[model samples]
Structures are given as structure tokens and as C-alpha cells.
Target: MMATADEGVILVVEDDGAVRNLVATALDVHGYRHREAASATAALLDLTSSTDINLVILDLGLPDRDGVEVIEALRGWSRMPVIVLSARQEDADKVAALDAGADDYLTKPFSVEELLARVRVALRRLAYDSPATPTEAAIYRNGELLIDFGAGVATRGGEELHLTPIEYKLLALLARNTGKVLTHNYILKEVWGEAVASDLPSLRVFMATLRKKIEPDPANPRYLQTHVGIGYRMLRVEEAARL
Candidate 1:
């Protein structure tokens, strides 16, 4: 079944009582059903006990275990969307959480509105990516950018884009995982095959070229967003517009 925007339960895991309450209250105000857990153990227990948890807002500084461990454990069996809401603002911390399978990362003292927006985006992506949702067309569209996977081509503003083989592969990879941040290592393995070593410099060159083809203004990219030391994300049209 195609879940509605706010149809599923969201679990908020935070060791701080004030922050937990704040997040939970915001969710409640926004008409989202949510559960709270103060530790990784409790969070994992709730996830295992209930089949209704479709998303998680986790704090990395958990009392029992770090949130990345929780993400790793969850990834062992589930592909559920996890948004890390932590005080850790380091680029390495963000990269670690993302590489561990977190869907998004938000620093501490975050905006409640931004948090809700991320939640909405995650749920929508879940619905779109669902096996039961009937995405047989296999086409990806965000604003002027359209990737016709069936035809093995991409177009912008009604014109076909002339992309090299490597550029095309990179575009296809990001389009397939739209709205999610993909790590450099993940992209390298997918595009260049598993045997390829960490070639971030090459990836950056390819991505820069790919952006020039799709983005109207490559200097300020509207489609592809860079997470600096982390990786990249394909923003949906609406999200890109706000950027």
C-alpha cells in the first residue's frame, strides 16, 4: 500500500529529556504519530517490537550506545529511513552516520520546521521507492531535469543532454537515489564497480561535469547538493527551489 505523507509512526530517540520532549511535541503538533526512547537499547526494542515504525529521529549521543551503532544494527535487517538529530557537527561525524545507513543528518539546536520538512521528504521518498507503489515507468523527474531510465537518456528544459558514459552513469546513480545523501565510496563502487579504489578526485571531476549539463547555473547548483566532506544528494525540485 502507498502510505500517506504522515501515515507511519516516527520514533524519536534522545537521551536528553528536554530535547526529546521538544521533538515529540513538534511532531504531535504537526499531526505525526511518534514514539520516544531515551537510549539505543530502548530505541532498538521499540523498533523490533513494532512493525509500524517507518522513520526514526535519532540522537547520536545515546546513554547506552552511539546512534551510529543503532543505525548499523538496524541496517543489518531493515532499510528503514533514519534521520540523525545530534549535537555532533563535525563533517566526519556526519559522514560516519551517513555511511552507516542514516538517511539524513541534522545538527543540534536544529530548526523544528526544518526537521519536519526532512521528515516529510523521507516519508515521501519511502513511498516512491516502495516495491508496491507501481513505479513501472522507471523515469525520474525533478523540476526541469528528467531522466528517462527506460530510454537511457537524460534531458533538461525539453532538450536532450549530451553526457559521456561516466557522466551518464553518475547521473543515473544519483537520480535513482534522489533526496538521499550518497557517500563518495558508495557512489564510486556503484559507478566504477566494486574493484575500483577510492577515487574521490575523479568522482568530483565527473560530478562537476554532470552538473554543468543538468544545472542551469552550475555555480549555484539547483539539482545536485554538495555535503562538502561527506558526499552529494539529488534534491527534489521543491527542496532545490528553497535552497
Candidate 2:
């Protein structure tokens, strides 16, 4: 098998042997090292044991447990990229999988080209950016939105925007960790402190308010992307690397 250090590992979790083999073949063709898990239990065990597995391609109908359960369980500890592959075509099913912490979803009968594209996008997010070091620039910008870490300010379209303390902290956290999904618990602990880390409702409300101010369309945000059940991701630097 052809492999490079940068072609990160993927875990294919599907109950069907044929689907698993197909996905594994695609991964191999694309130069991604992969492992196959026929059940959620096996997938979780692989996740716990393999430090190098960078992504998961999960199916919703596992023999032992639902794939959403797998996503939920995985999000409890790791934010590895999880792109759900399922035959369930309902909007509710997609939403459930995404909200359960799956990063992206693909319905059955998907094209290999589209699947590869999604894989690239997800892996690029994981590989292209590292956490901000102390020496890194304090200001982060994506077109209209700008976060100034030094001044502790967030602005849109070159205008100063008013934000509550918690809102500012949340924005700062997202800005600092752009491209990476921040789970609700992690965000709460960082912004609200560990004392109130379990307050999910408060986080949701604040996120909504922050979106309204920074996003041109709060209904459809550009800068803040929600990982549904997982958390949120600020636009990755690679998406705007040319700027």
C-alpha cells in the first residue's frame, strides 16, 4: 500500500461488508491509510486505541449500536473528523447525525468524486491549522469579520460591535481555535469556567446572539459553523489562506 506520513488515517465504520470494502478501496486509492470496523463497538475501540486515526466514516445502522451513539460517544472525548455515510435520506436523519456530532453527512449512492472532495475538505481542516501560539498574531480576520485578541474586540465590516463579556469570550475561543470543532463542554469550561461547564442552554443562547452580530445572515452563518451535536468551528485558515 502506498502511504505518506501526511495522508492521515481514516476509520471506516459500517455494518455491511460490501460498503466497508468499497470505502476502504476508495481510501486506498486516495492514498489514505484506513481501518475497517464492522460495528460501533469496534469503531470506538479503534478510536480509543489508535492515536493516529484522524477521521471516521460512519454508518448510521450498526449491528450493535446506532451510529449516532458512536458519534455522541466519540465527541465525549475526541473531535476527530466524522463524516457519516448512511442510506437514511431524510432531512431529520441528516440533522440527527450532524447534531449528534458528525462533521459531515453523505447519503447512500454517493459519487466517489464527491466523497473524495468531502474527505479532502475535512482532512484539510484537521491538517492546515495548529492552535495559536503566544507569539502568533493577535488579530484574526475573515473578510468582514475580525477578531483582535490583543484589544479583545470583534468587529464586522470595519465597525466595532458590542458584545457581552461571555459573548466576547466565546468569540475569542472560536477565533483562537479556528477550523477545529469545540465541543459544548469544552467551550463552556473555557468561557464560563468549569463551575458552569454543563450549562448548554446558556451557551446556545450566547452563540445565537453572537451570530446575529457578526454574521451577515444570522439565519445562515458564514463565520461560525455549528457541528450540530458536537459544537462549533470558526472558518479554517486554509479556506481563506489566499486572503
Candidate 3:
């Protein structure tokens, strides 16, 4: 949110050889060059000392410290995006990872296709951070939904809508890029971290809840609009904003 992609590096720190190779290979296939670390300490050292780590793919089950600990430490000095890669099978772990500072997560035994897609989303979240404000990541608005990129906050008709952590994130990802069609996998990877991808029905339930909070007409949502087979889009706030 603070800086764009051209501003630095994309760091990947994982301990599992299979996962490391798979992830690293996936990134390579996608033509993404990155830095990798086998432990949290090395990652922290790299993160602090280097000025180029634009994003991070971290593992919670580290040899030295908790994977979440690295994220907390890095967050102390920077807001670089952190995506967790772990085999931890608990919803609490996913929540803690996200609460700790991770922007996304992926469980073990994930497909290269899914991994690649997540990489795209995490990197896309940094779209505003590019060298230029490319049109794809251009400032978006609809009705009363006000997105102040500089503030990382949203408002409706001069009134702020208090959002839970997940709701706020869902809005930012969907609303900030209005017309774009994001998929469930994309949203799940971004918001729930990678461990919960199989929970699509749960994703739907959250979407419904999220819509009720932000939509003026939850039954006929005007802003948090669904795209049927696709994900969702925030109908231009101007369409519903009380000008």
C-alpha cells in the first residue's frame, strides 16, 4: 500500500524443499525473479538490510522463530506484503498469520496454477506501487464508497463504514479495482491466506455478510455487486453516492 513493485524485491522464505522448489519453480516459470531464505532469521536479516524486498512469501513453520514472528518483526520497520506458505491446518493459524501481518497464505500440496494465481494477486495488490499509476490499477470509485489510497480507508457518503479485518481487506481488493473480475481462489488466497482455499462455501457466506454491511440494498446490492460465475466488483460509488 505504501510503495509499488518497482520500489524493491520479492522475497520468498520457505524451509520445505518440496514446497521451496515448487514455489520457486512456479515463480521462475512466471518470469519472476526473487530472493529466497531457508529460515526466519536470514529472512529478517535480508528484509532489514536490503532495501529491495518489495514482497515476501513466508513459511510459519520455521527452524528458528515462529513464521508469524518474522512478519511481526518486518512489520515493525516496513509494510512490505507478506504471504504465508504453511502446512498448518487450523483456522486460528490462518487468522493469526493475517493478523500478524501476512497479506495472504497458501497451504501445502497446492497446485502450481493456484500458486501462480496467488502470486499475481499479491503482486496485483501492489499495482498502485508500480513505477506509474497504470490504468489497470487506477483510482476507482462507485457511489458513496470513497477509497483514499493514501489513507488505506474507505467511506460512504461522508460517513465511515467500520469494517472487520477481513471485510476491509475484501473491499480493498474488490473495490479498489472496480471493473476487474477477481475469482474466489484469488480472494481466498488474498484474504484467508492459502490454507482455506477448499472452503468455497465459507467464502460465499463471507461475501454475503460483506455485502450486507457495504451494500445499500443487500438483496439487490448496488456496490458490492456479484459477477455470477466470477467474483465481485464494487459498482462505481458515483452511481450510488449522494452528490
Q: Name model 2 segments beyond 4 Å from true.
A: 1-3, 133-243
* Candidate with best TM-score: 3
Tens digits of per-residue lDDT, candidate 3, 37-156, equal 999889888888887667788889999999999978877877667777788857678767766666666677666676665666566656544454433334446666676655556677
Give candidate 2's total backbone clashes: 1
Q: For model 2, what is the alpha-carbon lDDT of residue 189?
A: 71
Model 3 gets an lDDT of 0.70
For residue 10, model 3's alpha carbon misses the true position, in angstroms, by 2.5
| Each model's lDDT | 0.80, 0.76, 0.70
Candidates by lDDT, descending order: 1, 2, 3
RMSD of 1: 13.2
The TM-score that candidate 1 achieves is: 0.58
Kindly provide the TM-score of model 2 when superposed on the true structure, using C-alpha atoms.
0.58
Task: Flag regions of model 1 displaced more than 4 Å.
Answer: 1-6, 132-243
Per-residue alpha-carbon lDDT of candidate 1 for residues 20-131, written as tens digits (9 for 90 to 100): 9999989888788889999999999998889889999999999889999999998887877888899987666866676676766678788887677667766765654444
Residue 215, candidate 2: C-alpha displacement in angstroms:
10
- Comparing 2 and 3 by lDDT, which wins? 2
Identify the runs in model 3 with alpha carbons over 4 angstroms from their true place. 1-8, 130-150, 154-169, 172-243
